[model samples]
Target: MSDDNKHDRDTPTWERETLQKLVLATVREQRASRRWGIFFRLLTLMMVFLVVWAYFDFDFPSLAEEKIGPHTALIEIDGEIDVEGTGAADNVIPSLNKAFSDEGAAAIVLRINSPGGSPVQAGIIVDEIKRLRAEYPEKPLYVVVDEICASGGYYIAAAADRIYVNKASIVGSVGVLMDGFGFTGLMNKLGVERRLLTAGEHKGFMDPFSPQSESQKQYAQQMLNEIHQQFIAVVREGRGARLKETPDMFSGLFWTGARAVKMGLADGFGTVDTVARDVVKAEDVVDYTQQEGLPERVLKRFGAAVGEGAVKAMTHAPIPSVR
Candidate 1:
């Protein structure tokens, strides 16, 4: 045999060990990958569970579960009252329902501190309040104002049995408005031409980029006047004989609580504690406010912005703030 053939015949075959090592390494990698995947899935599930729990359970849920003793049930409206906000009708009404249904609840108090927001949202809350009050004639609903309760805030307060406030609290703004940008001047300065095309002449209505017509201006004003009249009627119906009406009561102006009392827009001066202790005749006060949780609020604002924009387009255009 040739030398080359002889060397080939003597060579050791190590391919089996090499192939075994390769197979073992591949199996270890797959096992590690599966373990890590399982770990991450468990972590994600735990996080989701915590967020859901927090969203449904109020900050201090123990307060809602206290012993059934005489107590005043409290629901707070602390920020701007918007349909998507914490003080929205959906948020407030559920709290009100829980308060009313509680066996030990002697009375219900709405702690309001807001500069006001959407009139539509306020109207929904007011209607619900009236309905709840009618259903629970034994439980009196009261509003205790903190710093301010204007426009829509006052609208909701009007449905309450009484309104109490501090001397410095801002009370009312009873009106509606439609504010928007008129960019005709900006466009003129910029030499920008707006090329808006629509099938209906008024389809491009209220477009800021286009020139505003006199008729459109008057139409907007008339719509505002109609909403203002509706607001006036609600206040009148709520305050009844208590409201000392004036020419400018619904002129979109705000007033201090003391002046509001003189005008009969508010009932008297008192704090939440005092209202509960004196008027409610219950010393123990329990908060039943359905506060928005961090995770849920974060999810809503971040996730629902796009969805809400679509909803708003289908619904009526954004009404000017009633602030």
Candidate 2:
């Protein structure tokens, strides 16, 4: 070895300096490991706390809260009246029952903003409203139309004690319809044939790819007329002497709120706030609309996706609806 290298290797402080550097490196690694362990522990605890909070908070408004004071109970129908939508009978009936049963509710207001939907769903809701109104004769139930309350919406409103609306709102359209696309011509152009086999003669009735039979068409019309008559009876029973019978009233024609009142289809022009304050004589409004929890919302979304696919595959039968 060279003379200078040998002298440095023989120095007394070289071993002491090397040992000190190694000790410092080990200390820093231990500190970093401890910090990460604490961070992970805190994160786990936070997740647990959130799950517990959501579990306890998932519920409708309590009855005790509803009895706090006198207020106008508001139930909103804001979408298509179908089994899968917010305006479904399942959702509205419970809310109506709750509002009617609440002792502190001076009156109940149904705020409707819908074009319309299933006739069956609307009929069920209308029936429930009639029952509630009869059971709670002291408390009145009113309807306040928003932008548009037509067809199925108007059907429900007919059951109310009074129907209020804005002059610009589109009201009425007491009619039912079943619509679908015909693909026979398109299939002929493409030189494609639909070979559908059914056990019953009328099993494939109204199939879009095939010509509709005269007998099936007449049967469908008869069924619709029966439902239409039922609708007319409900409206007459609910409106009593207020309704002015017109030839075109149940011909699926919609009118403005102003014209509706003149025709005796609506009572007067008013909004949710005015009806609650002036008509019900209660300024405070408590929303009794059913609020779905997080789990329900997620499940419904998934279910809707699957249900839509299934419905698309079978488009032969067009269910009657009001719109």
Candidate 3:
């Protein structure tokens, strides 16, 4: 009787210890799983942060670190001169002021390489260049054309004290043109109805889908003529006796750099480096174009992503530019 009881008790105690060990093992396994899960999550978060940081790291050169010693202040006007862009009034005006005000800057070089864009933008830049030049009469501003300086490009160039160009550069499309497609014939063929509503007469004057009236056409022509005349006056005044004016001088005619010099569209053939050394008499050149930083651009893009719908609603597509 005692042996049987002891055996039964021992069996139950061993089974219970085995059961407790199993429970402890299960708990350890669950804890290990939670720790691994947290590690994976932290690693994933770190990877995502690194990816975002690397994507925005463009490493653009900073100009503030450079000292304003005796040098040619260079502000490049690259790409289309739009109302708001890299080389617009906001960027160019400030650069011009800094260059003009610099006591050590021998001269300012406006290195332009553009096919031209908005007349309004160009006009604004030209006005600012003139003002800065007048304010700092001692500091001469020269335009050194890279590729093609036409339309609005020429408009800005005319304001400079002198204009230089590349040997193969295209210059002087001294004209204003407003271009658009007339979709009436296409709509008639495709049977696509155009339902445009306007409050004022000639509000849809330049609407592609609507038919243009004779008076509307005449009024548009007159406006273009006025702009063209303004261009002519600027060119005539800038070039003065140097310009070889003909019937086609102000007729949107373009010429090569060599021919441009002959036509007085450009002063002569030269590059930024050449003009800086010879004309400006300053070997060292300092860029004054205001550029955006990587962090700032990233934050701006993030903000824009958050508010794109609002910006799109408020903004209107500008009319066909009369360049």
Candidate 4:
């Protein structure tokens, strides 16, 4: 046998050895790459799942069980008084009940900052406040107006034992309004026709594109007057002899906090701190407001911006609001 052949038989050829090592290395690299790829893909899927879970979280806010010493309970009525918003009856009343029911809560201070909204919502809150007060007469409830408490805000505030306000705060708009835009002229200019059909007469009542009928106008005015009277009656019952009534008091006019105090619309100028420290005699103020969770806020805002806008645009009817 040749020396080279004899060496090849004893030990593998160098090329064959190199080739085998190269193939093994390639296989190991490929396996590692596939394992890393799978790991990354799984990581991405887990992150996506977490994001979706957070976004679609179904948990709504409930009153938390808090055990503490004597503190002034604070409930906030911030933003427009509506069914879904922060100042809604559902949100406010529950907090009120919890505050009034709390053994550690010395008193409740309802801090309000709103421009008013649905009269129905405001009325419901007012009724609840009245009921709660009557049920818990010893636990006093006061209102501390923030920026502006007008119309529906004031309606809720009126039920408080006392209302405090900052000197520059806006308060008191004792009136009802059903306001909307008339698009008839704009539609005419654009040469766009509005087609409205209904089974009942005045079914499309106060349609912005259509000319307002005289009878419908009178009916709307009468309804507004009746609601205004109801508002006036509430103010009278709440303020008692404190209110300095004027002819234009219920004429949809607003006033400053200082002016409100002078007109007997508010009790005096104070804040949540002052009311808690000085009036309630408890400096530690505990918030009892039922806050909207992330999901509720996201859904509500999305719906209002898209769906509510579309409905308002199509309907073009005046919404009876106290503003």
The candidate scoring highest on TM-score is 2
lDDT over C-alpha atoms for residue 3 of model 2: 95
Candidate 4 local lDDT, 63-88, one digit each (tens) = 55454789999998889998776688
Show where candidate 3 strays beyond 4 Å. Answer: 1-67, 293-323
lDDT of 3: 0.80
The list of candidate 4 runs beyond 4 A from truth reads 1-65, 186-193, 298-316
Q: Per-residue lDDT tens digits of candidate 2, residues 111-149?
A: 999998888899999888878878899999999999999
Q: What TM-score do all the candidates reach, one by one?
A: 0.80, 0.82, 0.73, 0.77
Clashing pairs in 1: none
Candidates in order have lDDT scores of 0.85, 0.86, 0.80, 0.88
- The CA-based lDDT of model 1 is what? 0.85
Q: In candidate 1, what are the lDDT values of residues 208-308, reduced to their tens digit?
A: 78887887778888888887787888899989999998988999899999999999999999999999989999988888887776766776677558777
Q: What TM-score does prediction 4 earn?
A: 0.77
Candidate 4 achieves a global lDDT of 0.88
All predictions: root-mean-square deviation over Cα?
Answer: 7.3, 5.2, 7.1, 4.9
Cα error of candidate 1 at position 202, Å: 1.1
- Candidate 1 segments whose C-alpha is farther than 4 A from its true place: 1-66, 302-304, 311-318
- Report the lDDT of model 3 for residue 26: 100
Q: Model 2 off-target regions past 4 Å?
A: 1-57, 60-67, 301-315
Residue pair clashes in candidate 3 = none
User: Which candidate would rank higher by lDDT, 1 or 4?
Assistant: 4
